[model samples]
Target: MTTSSDQQHREAALTDTVLRSFESCTDPRLKLVLQSLVQHLHDFIRDVRLTEDEWRTAIDFLTEAGHITDDKRQEFILLSDVLGASMQTIAVNNEAFKDATESTVWGPFFVDGSPEIPLGGDMTLGAAGEPCWVEGSITDTDGNPVPDALVEVWEADENGRYDVQYRDGRTAARAHLRTGDDGGYRFWAVTPTPYPIPHDGPVGALLAAVGRSPMRAAHLHFLVRAAGYRELVTHIFVEGDELLADDAVFGVKASLVKQFERARGATPDGRELDGRSWSRVRFDIVLAPHGS
Candidate 1:
């Protein structure tokens, strides 16, 4: 009979051999990444003593995830989000700077070429939700204003559904606008409401298997860009939202949480609400310099 120690040695040798096979990779960074990935992945398999059946199941899960992903729904990103991998990657890349805004997961719902709105304009575009006034200023770590910054914002409707989810080719609740000379921006949007992530796919199944919920915290998305600063991708969570403590994607940061104050009177730009109650939030953001 083969000794247990010999089996362990053989496994270790196999991992070394795989690592050596990447020596021919011309790219230094790629070689390093591949080697590290192989090292960790092999160690995980050895530590868990993963069986063939379990490996097959994992492969099946990945296959299903790929099968369900499309332009509108990204199941792989959903899987990464549920597993906290997406947030981990974001954390690793978005290093902290002096009072700079923290970055978060870029959820799968972002659509490029979003329609542009003007300052103090409305982004709802007829999306169904309570009206909200979102105002903010963009500045650098030194407190200098960064004017003409491109700010992109989006959120789900009151029913926890994005416009893309409707599959009717409609664009609502999403827009981009430029900052003013004072680095200020204000737009009308809907009050964010907590909703479950797409739980009908493989990610959802994984969550169910592990006894987890797919609920994401109520929030609005923001992607900010300037000429020389690092791009900032983040969102603001409702202060009192119950899901904040257990956001599905692990995307919430204390600094990103803000109060959505209720308003019953005159609107910010003197727009008549006609007796409709609204909400308002102020989110001033600070950007880190590139390479900071």
Candidate 2:
């Protein structure tokens, strides 16, 4: 089936009219962004010939997503994680700098303003679980040290629940600390364990409809910031963890994986870890230089 010349001209006219309307804009950056979005969105609609029902369903999904968000969670980030677009965008924007660390998605659960903690301290705040240690450094892309870089971190508790998920029970796992003079930093926290994405929301419903799992493998989340360097949001996964390849949010990167080694010595305080045992881990982060 071939379209009549008039029909083709009408579609072309619509495309031109929409695109040209933005040409008079003085802001070059805004103009370029609007142009690209228009081009891709138009192409998508034409290529898929999306049905009215499909469009309506999309609107409903977005509406519900907004409705479900609170101070502690972001539904849109969850949506993007499932689609892999968040990680892709991060990768594209965070192309290697001389020695800077790459940025990944600041996943939905990040709650700003965590408590400040001392070096070698536990962000777990006396929570129950396997003892885990996370240590790392912040360096420029050139491998130069970035001293005093602020490393902010947050993660779920032992019961696979975030602070927000609990009702005034205990403190959230949020913590903030700066890198030492050698650009190295270490902290004690429970080894991360796999947890399910909130499955009672609209996104969960979508996942269920598609026969997908909501499980995110155990991993530590980081938000590293430095003077004259780009801020980074990423995760360090435990080696041999079962969900590495299938993170519910698809946030894992091959380069970000680290081994959580077992250590037999006494903990930092020179005391036995309840006479059970203690595990040690080291995760170093490298950052990109300024103005890259």
Candidate 3:
């Protein structure tokens, strides 16, 4: 008869056998990574006393997540965001940029090839949201302007839905612009609104299972790139947003939040805005050196 000691011995043997299988790996880093992964996975299974049915359910959940992922949607990334893995990865890799703009999770909705817009052009494209003007300068950590930097921006409409969500093959509320010689750029966009991540997939179901809400705070995404600096992927969260303290993806940083103030009659650069009241935000971004 198999006793408790027998089961323990069998488990130990299985872990050793699996680890030994990686002995023939030629790459030292690969071998180390695989061995460490195996050890931690085995320990977690033991600590949780994971049942066979639970293992099966997890496998099924992951399979479903993969199945739902496509060109326009990334369910696995969504899962990573909900589980805080994305933020953790960002934290580990972005330690040197403390003086520069802090990095945050690049949500699953970023699309390439947004139309290039000129300075002071409108990015809202008639999408429904309060009109807002965003002007920012790109500078090095030493406060020197980094001229001719490319700034890519994208955000959801007032209803918190991206252009991709409609599957309509059109881009809205997204654009790219180059900084002028002064490292300054400006464009008009809609004020951001709180929205839930795609919640119709396995990640959504997992959030429901854990009694968690999937709402992200109001924020605008920016990707700044220059010839000789580290590329930055980050967000400017609206100050005093109710959900800022509880972003579903934990992407909010106190330094990244800015006050989007209400304005009347004129823009920041002294141009007459069309009689309608608007919101204005000024964000100066600093980039860390490439090797920093």
Cα distance off (Å), candidate 2, residue 155: 1.0
**Winner of 2 and 3 under lDDT:** 3
Q: Candidate order by lDDT, highest to lowest?
A: 1, 3, 2
- Report lDDT (Cα) of residue 150, candidate 1: 99
Worst 10 residues of 1 by lDDT: 1-10
Pick by lDDT: which candidate is best?
1
Off by more than 4 A, model 1: 1-3
Tens digits of per-residue lDDT for model 2 on 158-247?
Answer: 788877777675676768898889998888888788899888888899999999999888878899877787778888887899898888
lDDT of 2: 0.81
What is residue 81's positional error in candidate 1, in angstroms? 1.1
Give the C-alpha miss distance for residue 259 in model 2, angstroms: 0.8
Please rank every candidate by TM-score, starting with the best.
1, 3, 2
- Report how far residue 247 has shifted in candidate 2, in Å: 1.6
Alpha-carbon lDDT, every model:
0.95, 0.81, 0.91
Candidate 2: clashing residue pairs, number:
11
Q: For candidate 1, lDDT tens digit of each residue in 6-117?
A: 8999999999999999999999999999999999999999888889999999999999999999989999999888889999999889899889999998999999999999
- Using TM-score as the yardstick, the better of models 2 and 3 is 3
Candidate 3 structure lDDT:
0.91
Q: Kindly list the per-residue Cα lDDT of model 3 for residues 1-292, writing each as its tens digit.
A: 2349878888889999999999999999999999999999998987788899999999999999999999999999999998899999988887766589999999999888888999998887767788899998999989999999999999999898999888667789999999999999999998899999999999999889899899999999999999889889999999999999889999999999999998888776676656877898999999998867
Tell me the lDDT of candidate 1: 0.95
Q: Looking at model 3, report the run of 10 residues with the lowest lDDT sum.
A: 265-274
